[model samples]
Target: MPVRTSPADAPLRIAVVADSDTRWKWGALTARRIAGRPPELAGFLLRGRATPTPRQLAEVGVAADALREVTMAEFLRAAEREPYDVVVLALVGGAAQAALHGLARLWPGHARRPVLVTGYVGVVYEKLADGLLLRHGADVVLANSRHDAERFRAVYEGVGADAAAVTEAALPFLGGAPHTPEPGRDTVVFAAQPSVPESRADRMYLLRRLIGHARRHPERDVLLKLRSKPGEHTTHIEEQPYQKLARSLDPPPNFRLVYGNMGEVLDRTDLLVTVSSTAALESLHRSVPTAVLTDLGVREALGNHHFIGSGCLASWDQLDAGHRPSPDPRWLAAQGVAPGEAYEGAFDAVRARLAELLARPALAPVSPYYTPVTAPGYLPGILARHHLAPDGTPLPGAAPETEATGVRRLVRDAVRDAARGAYRHGVQRVAPVIRRMGEL
Candidate 1:
């Protein structure tokens, strides 16, 4: 008998594990767009458990009625009972890799798993998870950065990712309409997100200090703008909560919490300010001055000079003195990427690749997920050449064989070592769902 057709009937099962509300919002949007409709949807919020608020529901068109608060374990159980066609997992921070373990435990007996949509957060955790998921089951690993894609293949699980299947995508802004240009106004801007949580604490502090400096220096018209993408595009309002909080005291004439067209705001601006946002990198291509405010966490995560060379990373004192915050604009263009270009091309490529990889001729059901490595016995050997001992033990006594190697030699060794190490001592097992930041 011929079956009736409906977008909801043959929907792909997408499970998102996100570290923040924003990522989850975007992940859910992407899933609905790709999968079609309500009945076919399955999503898991990595953090908050509950249905979307009224505004949240309206923001994404998710049927609040259809949304469920199922745990990772519960989602997995349901997935097995009615086998989803694909699973999209959006993750960030420390929670991403852990979420995969939760998923693996649920499907303890399934053989052929669904296609996975991965949105990884940091380079460190992505590698940790990639080694695991690729070795065990994931059919596809969607990374947000080419660097991350390569890293996943090079170190984590060489065989875990299909080079052809790996698609480098942009970090989606979800629903806010992007900023358009305004006729004539210099509005070079610096972007910081209060919502980024403690991960951006250093940056947050630096921003506050700059605002204080602006109060004293009355000539520079420094604009501090928060990032507002297409999904939740809000008009520039001086009275907004974040702005009110940022500029609690009456600010000086030069400093402002500007709003409206971000593109126009940035395009007209003379300079940009930030810590490690990819936006700072993008502004450089647009020829805006960018500066990075550094502290302990930023220094530890990414070196200062690293972003400075790319543009938009600078010292506040330098910026206060009317000193531009960039060296070469071309370098910025070379490193920075536009979200539209990144998401439209990279993300689409991933979706298409996913469809291709799992096509009938290529499709194969693989595993019931498992994290057998928390204990020493089943641990996958994760041998980082940077710290590998004679017997493959990781420690301070690993001797740092190539830590002091020459530049050319270092690059060569990094490449060579990554491959050799993956083949020799790779042990991390990640869930099929993961992400890579585009800035990498």
Candidate 2:
């Protein structure tokens, strides 16, 4: 039996556990829209780069008290003190996956163990293993599109996940009405993924292609939008920065490196290109000419093979020939790109489902396999010992980083980077082995 709580008297308390700006943005937007007046929102972020940026805070207009940095142990401790009604995991990484497994272990049997919801921030094609874990770990998994939801459902069924957990939801980062392409703006933006900027050879090839495109269309202003500023770490550490390449190449006057508001940049952008980014999808939603560059093979992480047959890709040859990319009507319908009738149906369904969840005062669905005692086996024992106890109590005096901890982290990062390079180069044969190493 569901307890119909009064929205005015007792607002639903939501805790957004996130470690990235992209994920936090989604959580903040959802809270702003869904949390009734006098918002009961607490944004718990991990320390360092994961902390919400001032710009991000301004964009969402999140209350100062609402956003705070907390260590994993601290967050767990606070949850034990006063649990939220809903815990939204705004994460999509190995760390987040591991954290979810830990949270599942720590919260079971608690009186106020909130319903957990996890979601991807953007397009997901080849990352099925993590996707499966996220789906099974959370009480509800938010899918960005109908195609994605169906795909996740099929995978969840295959993985023996509870079939009732998935729900289709729009990405809150893309909040405004559908973008209409403006006239007289002949700007082309290559949404750069500086973090893990493909292979060195691939990077050079892409730069050369963009340069060639600019040469062919001198009237077009081409902007290379960087993922982060030089020396700044965001999610993945970039071994090679595009700024260095841009400086060496000495691109044409029309070609420039850009970093600022993505929406504003897209407003003036007539054409958008990327290896595989959420930006490509955003551009498509705006009705702009969007191209998924696939000079890299389908097997490569940046291939973006999902859009291959969808008519959104500009292959190496296509880029060379200066061909205009077109979107497949059927693909758009299947992908749930909106302003269409299909999107409206999906959006309404998601809102209705969310309303039903909000109506209930508590969301506690326990899993026999994920109790705190069992979670340490899935994650590293060290993480479990450092973060929480079997009875959901956070370990004391383990929250702060000491000098020794900092030194150890530096060494660990170097090793991880080396292993990542080896994995990228195909030196590592087993996917599971690499996945486990990634968790480390």
Model 1: per-residue Cα lDDT at residue 178: 41
Quality of model 2 by C-alpha lDDT: 0.64
Winner by lDDT: 2
For every candidate in turn, the CA RMSD to the true structure comes to: 16.2, 7.0
| Model 2 TM-score on a 0 to 1 scale | 0.78
Clashing pairs in 2: 105-371, 105-372
Across 87-142, the per-residue lDDT of candidate 1 in tens digits comes to 66654422333334434444444334566565543223223553434333445555
lDDT of 2 by residue, 1-440 (tens): 12224453576677887776666767666554444444478888765443445655554344524776666766665665564666777765544554565566565553346667777777776666555553466667777787888888887677565667678766655533455655666788998874434555677778888877787778889888875655444445455567766677867888888877567678788778888877877777667778887667654466387776678876757754667688987787666664444433444655566667655655564452234454556545534533654443456665543323587878965775565446433422344346669979
- Evaluate residue 360 in candidate 2 and report its C-alpha lDDT on the 0 to 100 scale: 63
Error of 2 at 431 (Å): 23
- Cα shift from native, residue 402, model 1 (Å): 57
